[model samples]
Target: MTGFDPDWWCDGAALRGREYLSISRDGVELARAELDPQSTDVDEYTGLDLPATVVKIEFFEVRKQLRGRGVGRWAVAALIQHYEGPWFTVAAVTAAGFWTSIGWTEARHAARPCSSTARYLFNANALPSLDHGSDL
Candidate 1:
């Protein structure tokens, strides 16, 4: 898969508080991810005291044609590598397995809602301790 090039993606627009990444093949956009630094959706959903630097993935989508072709996985992995920090997103029911397959673990406080929040801690230092035995 072709990797993301920040300079190529963010060249024209001056991204202030948000960052965007797009995955494409042969000039066609296959998937996209948007990060919002100010979002507290994760904390709101999970009721956890996440650090302020933890950004939320405001939006993430893969083209229908490319759904199971590893495009989304590659895009998310690239995002984690690029940002190198804590990232979280509220995932739709169809996407929970995808997130888990990509190494994201559901938050300890997360319920098995049809749509629930999931998190990826790229930096091990940012991972919080949780009591696995506790019920959400």
Candidate 2:
């Protein structure tokens, strides 16, 4: 699982102050993501409070043909290393497993359990984040 070598390129803080990210391996693009610091007072979808500490993930995707490989793992690991606690994202309900499997804890409460999107958080693992590919 440790073999995927990811190179990240980030630029342009124009998308609502979010930065675009691209991850590649040996010149081949493997994944893409967008990150923004949450500035709003509350989440419109779930009405959850948004604090300055939350870093919102605007987008995340791995190439279709590279789904099951370690590409996603490496990308997520890289992100955790670059950010502080805690990460926040509104994800499709179906993809909840991926978040949980990677040590993300759900932030959705019973009051908003059936919302169209689910919220998840990753707190940089107390400091170490992911250890190579094994933890990812």
Candidate 3:
């Protein structure tokens, strides 16, 4: 079990003054789960035997003032495009319903009982080979 950091909302000075690009127009931070490049955690989660890197997107929240403008969708799309892994996986909690509404299939249901609700895994495979300098 993992917890979302509260300081994630802090753009600068809080996170060592590091810059986090906002996926939304109002600069709301996008929650991102970065995987180990060596694929150490892939075997433990995804059933796929192949070693692959993944990034999990848990939530997409826009300010109440900026709701219903499709900004959240745009942010998620940008994140999916920016992620350059051989495979991508997400353990969507709050957004599981929304993920299913799109093309993401629920890989696991009631995967964890210790928690209050079930867990879901959504995955997508990337191209076999992508150019280093070009966008895939």
User: Best lDDT goes to which candidate?
Assistant: 2
How well does candidate 1 match the true structure in TM-score terms?
0.57
| Candidate 1, lDDT over the whole model | 0.59
Which model scores highest in TM-score? 2
Total clashes, candidate 1? 0
Per-residue error for 80 in candidate 2, Å, reads 1.5
Per model, how many backbone clashes are there?
0, 0, 0
Better of 1 and 2 by lDDT: 2
Q: Please state the error at residue 14 of candidate 1 in Å.
A: 12
Across 1-136, the per-residue lDDT of candidate 3 in tens digits comes to 1123544443333332222444534344433333332333343433544455455443345544554665555555555566554454555556567656555555533344355443343443543334453332
Prediction RMSDs, each to the true structure: 9.3, 6.7, 7.2
TM-score for all predictions? 0.57, 0.66, 0.51
Question: Candidate 2's C-alpha lDDT?
Answer: 0.63
Candidate 2: tens digits of C-alpha lDDT, residues 1-136: 3233233223333465776777777888788887776634234434344455566676677887788876776888777666654545545456778888877767755566676667776666445534465432
Worst 10 residues of 2 by lDDT: 1-10
